[model samples]
Target chain A: MSPNVKHRERNRRAARWLLGLSLVAALFFGVRVGLDMVYWNDPKHHEQQLEPWMTIGYVARSWMLDPRKLRDALALEPVPDRKTSLGHLARQQNIDFETYALRVMDVIARQKAATE
Target chain B: MTEVALEWLPVYGLPVLVLIIGLGCLGAPAPASLTLLICGSLIAAGDFSGAQVYVTSLVAAIFFDHAGYAVGRWGGARLAHWRIPLMDRARHMLKTRGGMAVFLTRWLLAPLGPGVNYMAGVVAMPLRRFTPFDIAGEVVWVTLYLGLGYVFGSYVSQISEVLGDITGFLAFAVLAWLLWRFIRSDLKR
Candidate 1:
């Protein structure tokens, strides 16, 4: 084959490989997004893992529960800094992390039940 | 500053992020990757959803990539009059290598982002050829930065600061080297 023909052939092969890779990526992202959406929509998924390090602010926003209501129900001090994780606050207030997790979990469970 | 922005994210939400990223892709000086990283940290911290942050940043980046492409498309030959690094080389790559050039620059030498977008337009790369590679490249960029933030959420503030300092120093070093090269070339001539 001529040099020009060889170059064109190489380009065509590259394009084909790119197209195949792109299709695989699209399929992967689609399935991942679908699974995430289903997981997020299911209330049970929220309770699956309640880590001590999670913040009150994070929990409120994720569950669509009111921060003020959740705090009050849990009888917690005002957390002005949203980044303050539950584990840190529990230590500061001399409260057990497990107790903190359980209280927040209870509130989350109640909120989910009310919505359903 | 990243902390301040992170704190505001939940209050301001996705619109702010989308706007900033769009502007950054259009050649505006903004901390686009840093913003994605912060969003990722927030998602990992449970302050925001991972899917939402990913989707928002992707759309904004791709939209602005198109805008930059449009500007290049409209400017055409006139863009060649402007001085930019690797302009001639980029034009050649776009012509010879095609969309793979677009894909590589999207994540690799991301600082040259706007330059590549504009060059693609100036060279009249077809929209069909540009869009797919652009989207795929953006996915890699978004996911990589976000994943870093998610895994290192607790240490993100320090990580961003260190990265920022390094980026600034590198940019200065590159510019100084380029200036020196230009002067040497002129002297040689």
Candidate 2:
């Protein structure tokens, strides 16, 4: 075979391998996207995980609690600002963040029990 | 670092966003998208105003993109002088397709955005051309993620995961198509 023919053959083989790899990758990610969308849309997965990043309002919305009710339940004296996160609040109050988070969680649980 | 950035977001607000988004634009491994999503949720929760988040993030992204470009231009100045065929082809590709590359990578193929910025600079793409596309793409990126977070609220993490997968899928699908095209053209030749 001429050099040009050999070069074309090599390019053809490389393209086939690359295309095969790309197909596999595309399929994998496509399947993952579908699975994630299904998982995300399920009501069972709707429960929000409470974290240090959550503000009072975020927690209130996530748990379907009235923001005013949560504020009153937490007895945030002077009312923590709208943007104040539970972790930041804990820091200001000289409490460990986990302890403060647990306290907030407890408050939520009790409030849910009362409403139910 | 991602967790620390997320945890500090509510405490520090826009400044945290500004810092992370800027760093992400400059090719840092920051969770800039997640920050934007959480900020959108915060906006929904009334912790932040939409205008502030939009304006701050857009500016930070554009500013840092230019900063990345400047770094690339400065650092790659010597490399640009090399007469490699690959470099020449890359320069040609950037001249022809750099706008679309800049725009798509900004939002749709976002993981490549920083690298594209650097490459555009290395190829000495015109600033005037780069700026408009960069701004347009960043606007779409900022708006899309923030909008999803705002609308989805508590599901932001899951939404992020799904969006990430979709981006991966699109990238690989495009690669597959390009490879197929190359094969067809090679056969013709």
Candidate 3:
């Protein structure tokens, strides 16, 4: 065989490494879909549970869990009843509109959690 | 995009095309790591099949990365004459940070990987100097994301949870470290 043919053969051999990577990709996509189906159907695994925004809100709420405890952090008075309507609580506090909005959402989440 | 479009062959094929096109145009402006993470999860769930797809992707990424490094390696003969618009910042980044910047962008965040190559090409960065860094970066990138896919098995939501845990740990560490530093600095001052 000519040098070019030999060179081409060498390249082919080296490229075989990609075959393994291809298998992995196949497995990845295959398994991923299966897991999603299971997760979507199962109520306990949180597969299809909350919307994206709700998850973010949940995490944000955890960050400010102790709003009233920390002297350095923003210290807002806790709503007297976790079940109180957010609109009513916001109106009573006279807080900034943005602040009230977020508080109202959190308050609603708290109320919703209580009922659940 | 539709789920069908995201099949194994296309994922692998597109990047290879990019590599064949000589990588300068293909290398830059790569997608974010989150996308790969998303893929990782999908793979685990058994949503996609085709080993050829990932292998193609890996090879394409490495190939393009290398091509970019090569273009950069060759002194500015091509770049100075090339008529690319609004790529000064990237070109500047390539110059100042050198191979470290290239490596990091390729390995860490990833979006910048191809862009770094283009910039290096624009300025005529030498191929010899660009090779090692590009190689290392590709290895790192492949290992991290591909490994994540292998281990986690691909379910976007599950991977999201893992991501959440990582984010939480980093957040807590940052907060604690800052608090400690603030106290110590205040006492000294």
Task: Give me the candidate number with maximum DockQ.
Answer: 2
Q: What is the TM-score of chain A alone in each candidate?
A: 0.48, 0.57, 0.40
Best by lDDT: 2
lDDT pick, better of 1 and 2: 2
Least well predicted 10-residue stretch by lDDT in candidate 1 chain B? B166-175
Once fitted onto the true fold, the runs of candidate 2 whose alpha carbons sit more than 4 angstroms away are A1-31, A41-43, A80-82, A89-103, A113-116, B172-189
Candidate RMSDs in order: 14.4, 4.0, 21.4
Give a tens-digit lDDT track for model 3, residues B77-121: 555663322234335545666788667666543434565676676
- Per-residue alpha-carbon lDDT of model 1 for B1-189, expressed as tens digits? 433443345556688688778877987777777777767767865677889888989988999999999988887778665443335434665777768767866665465578779878997888889999999999998998889888766544445545544334343343335444443443344
- Give lDDT tens digits, candidate 2, residues B12-63: 7889999999888987888888888989999998888899889999999999
For model 1, the superposed segments whose C-alpha errors exceed 4 Å read A1-116, B1-6, B80-89, B161-189
- lDDT at B118 for candidate 1? 89
A1-116, model 3: which lDDT tens digit per residue? 99766754554443344334434444554555566567657867743222121222122332333333321122334443322222333445775435755654555457446546
* Complex DockQ per candidate: 0.04, 0.52, 0.01
The number of clashing residue pairs in each candidate reads: 0, 0, 37
Query: In candidate 1, residue A52 scores what lDDT?
Result: 44
Candidate 2 accuracy as lDDT: 0.83
For residues A1-116, write the lDDT of model 2, one tens digit per residue.
Answer: 99766755765686789799989999999999888878867889877667767888898887888988999888775454766777677888899878888888899999889889
Candidates 1 and 3 compared by TM-score, better number: 1
Model 3 chain A lowest lDDT segment of ten:
A50-59
